[model samples]
Target: MKILGFRGNVDPASYTLSDALPNFGRASGDRSHAHSGSTAKGRDGADVPIAPLVTIAIPTFNRAELVEKCVRSAMAQTYPKLEILVSDNASTDGTVEMLRAIDDDRLRILTSEENIGAIGNFNKCIDEARGDYFVLAADDNYYRPDFVSKCVRLIEDEPGLPIVIAAYDVLVVDEFSKDDRRTVPARLSKKLSTGIWQGTDILQEYLHGRISAQLLSSLVRTDILRRNGGYSPHPCASDEATWIPLLMEGRAGFVDEPCATYMVLRESLTEGFTADKRLGDLREVLDELSAVTAKKVSDPAMRERIQQLLNRYLAYMAAVNLVIYRRGGASLSQAVQKLWGWRTVLAKCSVTDFLSTWRLRSIVRILSPQPLARWMAKNGFDQWV
Candidate 1:
């Protein structure tokens, strides 16, 4: 069988990728004889149960070189029955050609004639996916060999389960030295213990500043996601925005283990913007998220509570981001003044749930003089920008 968008059939069993990429074979290989039927290799290399087809729809724009790792990670999954699509947003930098060179029959290179913006390209991936389950992995992050297998069984065991979120590690790279990289595990709230997560519970906990990670790299039941408006297109808080509507559909699942890697680039978070994305203001982003919640939730009381929580959460996060944004050479005093302006709101938010060890350090980190951010990071504090 040919990969999704490309023509011509080829035997996947004999298809071997180039040996030159930095860390090539570490990724998992095809299951069974040729991935024609599901056969997963367990952590012990023993066979585990396998299931239906899964589509990993990766959206990309340029960065042909960097995306190699991401694609290789998807290709390495131990779980069988897969279709991988690299949704190229009409990149002129040879992105499509680079992906097409991979000989894996399961790999497909879907290109747009014109450059669609990030949101449009993301939606295009969802619309074009044909698998029973779908995963929209960002081109920057890599997945563990068991990422799909980890969550798929849980989701499939419970028919109609909207989604399953696997905890991920954020790859934090030192700004001055590319080689100095650390993986910080994104912790989930104790309130969201591993197992079944109710929709309303997720909605409330997430908005109340309880769940610290994100919903971006979720393993979603394809039909449920499409039935509920796909991913939310909000640029600023699109991470949470995408989850709000889907959670409204029903209860979901959560696996606390780190299955995928979430890249925390200084250029995007600390340095204010990346080559392709603009780090929008958190206040405005949360405002848009509140509006999204209002539309999805039916209860008036829950809506008001969530909005209030979001505002408080906003004050806290914005303070953190402001502290982080200052790393981009922003004036310390002026930024402090901006943070000081939210003093009352921050105080209220802090008294309620900011006593957590990390939260306390986050407060200390933000209030810290501009020079101390790095020191704090080195001292076991996650410098989440």
Candidate 2:
């Protein structure tokens, strides 16, 4: 009976949403005549099949304002069969109160007794999901209406594919302009022109430091996820660093349409987690991933790609530490620590590649980006970088 209002409309529930929302009734009608059961309307007012029950699982800890928009986005999906699950990590805020007031039967709220960390909360969401496929919806980001439907079609069409990655628009909500949005379509061009990378092209790209897209861009197959032992337990890039290798089991397909929007936060772990001591944690995880991928994958090509990716990550880590030193985030002593640690990994890699990255970084530091980009372009280091 309590149909709360969202951002834009309380004017009139369009015919489709009106029927879908629980206990729908006209403003003037008798209060007793509310429609309760699921009845989805098509574009021309015909009833289409209700979508397969989709569980959009969100892991939350505070950020009440952001979670509301995320829930609204899930509710707005054109697909009829959706169940929104919010797994709260025991926040002291009024997050629970805010959710309790929402009158939708489709939305389910799950909570932890105490504050579990984000990784624990996420794993709980996965364990609780009943949908044939599970979508990891972050508290801070949201999806377009077609997200579920498009992904469902992709997975169903090629049921064997372990992951269906939809193109997503990166929304740098804080500082970046809308013009700065990047598209993350699976690149066939890279597959061909780059030649067969490591073992699998996906692994190769990941090894090459190219799999930096947001987690929201991916809708993972539940079975494949479970088989791989879920989220990475050791506290470093768990969302991304874990999922990329799991998806590497088979080819990753990309949908052309933008399904989700990632709202970049200044304090987002992907950015700040690489600071201070956390960088060491991330480096350890990357190292573990490299070792595991190499041992597990049967294909020699994949192992090579995984090793190359590990090498590239070592190089990137060195570059990042150098930047930290230049920007005063790290002391000369800390920079020395990083250089000593990472240079060892670099030493294991091909000398040409190591020298190329070192030369490129020095060039960038000396000259402006324009000249650096031009010079790198002149050499083939542009693509490798």
At residue 308, candidate 2 shows an lDDT of 72
Question: Candidate 2: global Cα-lDDT?
Answer: 0.53
lDDT of each residue in 1-385, candidate 1, tens digit only: 0011100011111111111111111112122222234555432243433465788988888778767788999999987778887888788888888888899988977777876666666777777776767888777778899888877767556544667777666665554466666655555667777677766676666555445335545777666666666665444445565655666655677776677775544454443232112223344456666776678678898777777776556544554455454555667676667656656435435544333322555556555665676665655444343
Q: Estimate the TM-score of every prediction.
A: 0.74, 0.67
Candidate whose TM-score is highest: 1
Q: What lDDT is reached at residue 6 by model 2?
A: 11
Between which residue pairs do clashes occur in model 2?
198-301, 198-305, 199-301, 199-302, 207-309
Candidate 2 C-alpha lDDT tens digits along 276-296: 344455567667777777666
In model 1, the number of clashes is: 1
| Clash count for each candidate, listed in order shown | 1, 5
